[model samples]
Target: MKKSDINQYGLKPVPDPKGNSTGKAAGKAISRVVITIVSLFFATLFIIGIFMFSYIMSLRGEEIDIDLHSLNLDYTSFIYVNDESGNPVEYKSLYGGESNRIWVDYQDIPQYMKDAMVAIEDKRFWEHNGVDWWRTLGAASNLLSSGGSFGGSTITQQLIKNLTGESDVSISRKLKEIFRAENLEKKYTKEEILECYLNVVNFGSGCKGVQAAANLYFGKDIKDCSLAECAAIAGITQNPYAYSPMNFPDQNKERQQIVLSEMYNQEKITKEEYDQAMSESENMNFVFQEATETGADDTINNWYIDTMIQDVVSDLQSELGYTKEDAQNMIYYGGLKIYSAMDSSAQEMAENAVANDRNLNSDPDMQCGVYMMDYSGRVLAIVGSSDEKEGNMWFNYATDAKRQPGSSFKPIAAYAPAIDKGIINYSSIVQDEPIPNYFDDGTAGPNNYDHQFRGPVTVQYALQQSYNPPAVRVYQQLGPQNAYNFLTQKLGFTSLVGGGVDDSNLGVAIGGVHEGVTVKEMTAAFQIFGNGGQYNEPYTYYYVEDHDGNVILDNRDNISTQAIKSSTATIMQKLLTTVVTQGTGTGAGVTGWQIYGKTGTTDIDDNSYFVGGSPYAVIGVWTGYQNPSRLRNTNASKSVFQSLMGAYLNTKQLKQFTTDSSVTSAVYCTQSGNLAGPGCPTATGWYERSNMPSECTQHQNTNTTSSRSEEEEESSSSNTSSSESSSSSSSSSSSSSSSSSASSSSSSSAA
Candidate 1:
């Protein structure tokens, strides 16, 4: 017998009995078969009812994880920043859970859309108590004739399954699901149930719910959806993967017609509506966000996005009284609109600058990190890795990694504080020799690029040359604990967890703290010089608002503090300018911008760093292997740093550095580093009004030669150290540059 015939009716004898002798027995056997079939069918239903009753009793002692009363659903949150025109632009979006649902309120849902969903999913969804008796009877009738499995489930039943996260095909699962669905219908209103069904339902393309679907396929808000789009969204619930509006537009076209036809038949929509929807579906063309130039790959979380997430999460905990996990959940599902501090132009420039692998001049295994921010502590852009972006929520080198800053710490840990405390000035004489009682053995050795002492040098000369001994001498005078206090308490360097002993030494003079500094910390530390002694904590977002547009957290409360005296900062700023114009940082300067920064290379040349500021922004760049090893080339870091600096220079309006009234310039003796007298060789130096030096009557210099040389200025760019021990230098001077050029050829060939 055919399957259709068996489904249409109970078991019947095939072709009657061919022979007459066994006809009586055949009739008797057929009667027995029909009776048995009917008995089993009713028995199964009876068994299902009894099993559900038992399940209810068992549930009295043990509770399921799902709490029906809560009925919570998560939605996607967005990150935005105002563009040059001052209009908000979305930079990144974060979904609340693994399911990327963007919730829409019932009030925002269109009426026709609701009608289409009901007409297609469950026609009597408004009347049925979770399980539709009429539909169940028809499905049972079809099963009896065709031996087909049960395929009728109301919207309530589907919702119950979705809530429980259960997909078992067993009879027990089906019965339990049906009873729970009935319970759900009794407890919740039809509008509430329908609203949830639409939100939690998957629509493919990594989207869940009507809002995500509308945003993805239609590029419009759910409130503005057309009847045709509504039908398309409703059709996807049948099988999202196979009938996704984005992935399978053709299949969706056919399914959309079924939904529209059902809506029309049920009188949920007018004939005119049906006709217009049908016409619209005939030529439906889906538009994806990735097709636009502004859209980024949603799977990739770049540096700015990662930093914003960390900042928002931290603020959420403090401001809203939420745990870290809870705050994270609220961010993803709460439909929040976070106004971030990211500048789109700056971010693009920074990512392009660091991701330019060919210009990096190192193996793919080598990495680079960059952090950029303005004077107000608003983070503009951050690049954490050198490798091509592959996925999201990655390790951010800019914010997470605490690598040594090399000589970069000279300005922050030693010179800045020294000038602030009145222990040193722009032209103060410092001895370039070993510090006493600095080590556990009561002996100390100075670290230098060329491993040669320059004897007595002025403070400006020592900083421009990145000499370790002078910084150590000054660090000693400033006192290690005092410097530590200035770094942690004033500049907010969290990595200097000295615990009283580890960091109380000379290592900090050369970027050797107990722990290292993050690129973010190092960048923020430079803000004192950029903003005339003010240090504002680096932040990524301005504020976050709830779904209804009420402000929930305000991050604009971050205050700027006077990290150093304005006069001291002014003098230090001028000294840093000399580093770029006449010292190791010349290679990192942009043409029209007055770039003032320090260059630092480790004693072993394993890492290279450039931390500086222009009138527009403060930039910090680090290049080296993730594991501590000598750099292949240190020059590449400066080039990368210049590009990041140029990004801000070329985009923002140029503003000159603000000079304090207490800062003044004077001519000083090149030899004595004191006020110049008659017939004394002199150079200009800036000093605070209270800290001016006395006249240099002791100097009688006849030589009119320049105090610094052009050849020494080029040394840092060329003489880079390596793992093969080819050379050693901190921000190389020309002495090692020429020597290493000849020595590195042999090392390269041997390797």
Candidate 2:
């Protein structure tokens, strides 16, 4: 009944003749090939596949979890802020910490709020099952081009990532996310997926989700958010830190507009509604509540130490592969030996300075923020209050408060960048006259504080007296891009508002910044001036160790970026000394200390600043009110700084500032701020030795009589002679003091 037909091709095999055996026999031998060889090749492939599959399987973690419950984080971990002797000392313990997340049900979330998020996050969210394959393929292509970076992940995929808290940049991890997202979509409805995603997305400022973010940013629950506020909240999920509403308002406003535009383009809202939302957003004022307290119980940690705890948790999540929850858990249970960057001797001095604030400012409401760091960029001490700290984990003014720098920012944003770029130098002549079109409306130039312009002054003299016009002129020459880069990128100023908020305006050089600068950032920024031009990012911790003494996170001296030339730093260092000795910062000087610094006072006189550097440490002090008002005690910051530095320096063996061989002193005309030629009324100034100033062209061959007459004309409105006399007197008695306290107070009065 069965029929066999193996020879379907109609080929017949027969014995070959001896002559044809070489050709026909070999060709026909292909028919006699065995299965063993075929199996061997496939077997090798199978084995390799098994190895790969096993490796991928190894990388797979626990089943995808979207749970909203808190973790079991226990045990006490020791925190260290450097001791009074400048060594790591135990700060306090970490118990169980409270969570900021408070889950709201899916029904409670407003329809427009949901629309805003879906519009900005995923336009095709409702139509897609899980992965958007077209976009996925484009992302894959980009991934290949970018060499392992995975971009354009869908909302479903983002949810999978958020649930797993895994950011491994590998093909296996991406595939795992894709598979989990597909599974999740298959098991749950789109509403469920959206609910889970909304609840888990991080909105920065310690907010876990929309609910927490609404409470933190708006001082209300998510259900109570206005249409404009909802759009603002939706915008923050992309880049939380840069778009933080309270910290950097101008940047956040731009991001909010993008989100609103996305909603309109997607037909999620009508034109009329969009216009109304945009209008409301334009005038919206965020009711920013102070993140003043944490839920840690029975804590002795100050604001600085509290910041250290937060930093440790962050580093664990980044440097190690812990999630935020896991990192927090490890902070309590991982038995870690965390070391902070604080120097205790400086901390004690800072604390004492704040405690004795009554001596400087009579008003108890006048709060001060102080940041002190060594030349190597180790944050020595940070004080955020004038009164003794009351509650646990209160708001940190030293690091968090963004206030205008006024003239104190001159060295960092204006002169230092100019000097580094060779646009201006220590003794370069700059006119204190009006710069054309200085204001945005092009009305007039920056005026001197005393309402009198001193024509043609040295850079040293201009900075010494904190003149606004010269600083703005120098900033114009150097340009805003240079200063912005130097401040934000090189110096690690994270709070500067970018993206055309008039950051390019000449007013910024005179400290008219919109959001302004922080004391912590300013202190770290000044490290380059005293330490040969390398800018070290300010860090809270040094290194972390596990219970067994194994180094887990080493944060010791991150490779410093060379921001400016060492010669420029050395020259600036000497120029700063003039500010303390002969300039407006005279109140900040301590006897026998190589004190160098600049003073800043706001136009409204609400903020006062004195940022100074000694041989060993650089410190910044800001004195203002909680709700800024006209502060009459303008010298409070300088006085507080003097008291602290006097006590701190008296305890340590003194050291001189590091100088480069390329730095040398020159006699410059106080009227010209240039190399003194014949008949020039000159004063001692510092310059970069390699690029020393040319002799004054205006005064080179002038007769003595005319030179004297010209000097009188310039000096009538300026204090050049008096400044030199005070400088000479201060520099002479600088080394004759037995104690810095007595000498500083006596010299402070004299100056």
Candidate 3:
């Protein structure tokens, strides 16, 4: 080595021994560092992978234990209870769909649908666990070359994203979907996943679920769907409206044909089937109403229904435990099964009557509100307008409106009490001349509808003619409190009293003073007589059961307190019967049945009503303008009561109940409110008036005819009195007490 020192003496050797040693040591250090860094990176990735796996596994369906029995989740917007014939009576829309979304088991899906979806969306659905590396690589290469995004997602991955509501744009998001899909694949069979996937997907028009889409597109059930229709539906999976036949039929057809070709290419369908589907017609008939420009302005085009919705909200908040948010959510989201009492037949009739009435239709701006109910106080049907497309603006007119009842409130206040107290028989005599009331200004008097006095007339005649003067006299004699008590305390009406009125009296009786009356309250008062005095709270929901079929609430055997003696109710019934058969409500009489009803028209013609009942049902109809202004061009000549009766009396729903023969007769007095008695003297009049005797002095009287014609009038009067006195009695002090025992038993059980 000393001899080789020539290398050091000359120059530092490129191959120096010490240099070699240093290089070796440096290499060792670098190698150790590389190994450590690589180890840390892999360890971090492993931990992350483990955590992700655990998280996804935690979200498996089997791990979920939601209480199906206590979902308290209302899905009202998407559900409507069916009628006895299994036909849907109402339509509910949630998620912007036309109707409810129904789910079917995986095994129920047609094999063709599964095969078609697989062909179009993911041919390798079964082979891939979550993500396919080969597909991702191919998509990546295509994206780089063409600068367009390409989906490499499998069916499992798409389902995971849909069910979990995960985003799909970013790589990280895609990774999460992959993990979820992997977990889903492990927790459920392929069939279950596919079934859920099809149901959870969205179609157009706010529709969700395959069943809804099938019905909406093809007007058929999923199981019965045609190949052409299936192709159209399959084409919609990626972009619903983009392939909507409703909007773009020709384009959608082409799109459907493309799917059909894909199905054929993937061996999901036979060549002949694909060809037939491609050749099938794509004609779609959609109904759209035309709009008209008008000079007359209409507020609340659907005020009837809108008003009802508002009232419903109020009721839910007040009676049920629901907040504003809760109510809104329930209407839009909850799948609640609401069995409305509305009789579809009655509703249809009311709508048709109002629509076809030339007088009403002449004024394009005019609208009508009609509601029908069962004697049990359950609302059977409601109509706000003749045309449903006009919107439900007419809704809730029976419950939300506070209008003066005009003469309609008269019976509740005056006649009902007079008959109850035996103040006068149906033929009692009364003077229709002016009777002064000392008002705050110390000058007031009542008048007839024509502002003229008819002078001396029987109470029956006074009410029949809707004479305000006689109503006032009866009110004065009955005392204001007696009338008020009869309405509120006896009839269970809550709308007739309140505000500044200290006692419900003559003022309330004649509709001269009142806070306001809703159609519901006014109509319900009459229903009490229809139901023979039972007063149960009105309800729409019959029962509520959990997903597991456990009962949460049941109202099948509901009952309520008796508001009046059955005998008293019978008396009112007889008086009302007179109204329909021979009085102002004559238009409301139904052929072949004993009908009872009342007619009310408000001041300025702002409102008009006809409330009536049969043994089976009670109905109320309202016509007016919401602006408190008189309906322009209205005659006030047509009877709204007639329209409602024409509609309700013909309904098949009413035929379900057997007729009760107890109700009969017609023509009763308003003052004394009974058959002709000592107070009344019948002179030639309607049969209701003639079926009485001279004994009812307080009920009927002889009309003073021209002096020159006295002889002939006297002969006619004699004939009339004999028949009138025996006509009918509005009092039934006997029937009500007899039925109380059975009613009490059933009602208490309900409570």
Candidate 4:
């Protein structure tokens, strides 16, 4: 009864044609409404997605840091060298690679570089967010049947891909890139992003960026490159080899004209300027010298730069608290401003000195390092060379090398210290004979350079003559610790080699240490003597500036305290001076100036050194066989220092510059501790004065009874009191050293 009642509303359990028709119609209507709503929602979502994606795609990619310091490069290794007189010299590099290229900001880039790039790669680069929608659409439509397999990616898009390593190449990918590019545009100014792109994008031919390409295409840096040259570079972006002036001169020229025309059409350049540029382009002789593709054997090509890079990394870690990656980035991409002390002229002279030498050039087994510095202890030039490979300029002996300095180490270790202590004057007698038990051990035997000795020589003579036995004898009395301290602590040297001889003996004096010394160390030590015994830490940079020219680090006025006594330095100077006048350094003689230095030759003649300074410049030169074997018998007789000096002084480039206007010269008697010379005929001499007459030649003598002598007497009296204070200070220093050691031990224990 209940079932019938429930069904009765429909009347009976029977199929009603009207009811079935009504239900079917209702179901169909509901389905249609659902489908319509879903379709509308999806259409709305798709539109929104497209718009959002477009907005995002139009955004600029993140600002890539185009700072010069962010790239992997040698910042201070640039080509500018100057003497103390502020006279610049040209530093020439034989290896033409990106290492020599310099970066310019987008704003500073010549209109031609920008115009050419826009002309070839993306005309709308400055105008687009990150993508050119019209170009993309056109490319897609053109390649529609091929599924958007076309070429319309803008410079900005390519930059993003290069930076992010994104491989996606779909319509969707393009859309996403546009959105990202738009974001990048927002985050970075157009100038900044462009700089990043220009510095980072690959231009083929082993060139990763435009700067590298500029160097590869043109032997000069980007700043020095001309408009036609810029056009040639721009012409090659599409297909570097296809348009490379080196491989396809005509194609490259045609491409360059196209760039010039685009630049003209875009009005990036004035009509007259464009016409001139085009005219110049016709005669633009791109000297298409192929850069030595050294990446094939990274270990062999320019190993010096690699070693320098390692030091640069270490320095960045110490100075800027940067990781290895951060240092690499700083060098390759940071756009850092690096001011180096390198004198391009001196460097060129140094390089040519090695390259042009008949003996060195003929021998494929020679290695050498040359360094130059101003009187301020700042390095001005460096030449790293090792045996030539036929016509290839490949080897670098400067930074990668370490070799014994020989007698060159004596002036730094023995003479400087003795002068500082006032123990040995320039005229003090030093008998160059067989050193009797120089080590105070029966095993000790004194040896001379050629197994010969000069007898009863002055301290200056011994040093100038590079008499090894006298040096060893002098060192034996002074103690090995003195030499070690002078080298490591006073001279600021690094890397100490061990000798079996005890610190109590003369082994240190005779260059007994087996550890190799870097050219940097030799250069720095020489610079200290030149700079009045003040240790100006060798630095490549004078100042660092931000992109906006804000100084980050400026060491222009910074100078360290006196490392050795002025009197000691004076004696050492006199002796070194004689080196040029009468000894092994005769070839280094400069007629118009006073030059002082020591010549060094190790046992078996593996390494030879010349470290010297004038009021103008300090220079260090080293020569050796590639395998560290004895030099050729002919070379063995030849004075390495003399050769270096002859090359340095005779170079036309070096002759053009003057010393610092501020420098003043004078001489003092080393033995009597006075302004007059000792009784030696050669010792009595005229000291230089700022305004001495050309013929004025007399040593300023002092008398105890003279008025000036009274003043000197008073000054000496005061100095005696100062010395008493110094003695007390020495006691205090000893206590402090002991305390420091205790504290260090305590800290270690705590750790």
TM-score of each: 0.62, 0.62, 0.51, 0.50
Ranking of all predicted structures according to TM-score, beginning with the best and ending with the worst: 1, 2, 3, 4
> Sorted on lDDT, highest at the top, how do the candidates line up?
1, 2, 4, 3
lDDT of 2: 0.71
What lDDT tens digits, residue by residue, belong to model 3 across residues 333-364? 44444443444455556566666777676766
Off by over 4 Å in 3: 1-78, 85-320, 386-395, 490-492, 497-505, 546-555, 632-640, 651-751
Per-residue lDDT tens digits for candidate 4, residues 1-751, read 6755767677457565569888989999999999999999999999999998776645435344433335443222222335657755443322233543345677666667876787778888888877788998888888786653566878777666555544434555666666667666776776776777676654534354566666566766666778778877888767643565654678888998998888888878888878888898888765433344333232122322333344454666677666443454444344445455555456556556666777666676777776666666556556666444221122345555667666667777676776566555545567777644332222223545445555766565566556666675566556566777777776766665242222223444544443567767777787655555677776654654533557655668867767875444554565566666666665566666677776666555556666777666677777777676755522321333445455555543433222223233433333332343423123332222332213212433433312233223223433222110000000011110111111000100000
User: Which residue runs does candidate 2 get wrong by more than 4 Å?
Assistant: 1-73, 81-89, 96-298, 321-323, 359-361, 497-501, 546-550, 697-751
User: Who is ahead in lDDT, 2 or 3?
Assistant: 2
> What's the distance in Å from true for residue 423, model 4?
2.4
Can you give the lDDT of residue 278 in candidate 4? 86
Q: Tens digits of per-residue lDDT for model 2 on 520-629?
A: 88788888888889988777788988767898887674788898889888888888887787677766799988998877776657777888888887889988888977
User: Which residue pairs overlap in candidate 2's backbone?
Assistant: 83-344, 458-673
In terms of lDDT, which candidate is strongest? 1
Candidate 2, RMSD to the unseen true structure: 13.7
Candidate 1 whole-model C-alpha lDDT, 0 to 1: 0.73
Assess candidate 3 and give its TM-score to the true structure.
Answer: 0.51
Whole-model lDDT values for every prediction:
0.73, 0.71, 0.54, 0.56
Error of 1 at 701 (Å): 8.6
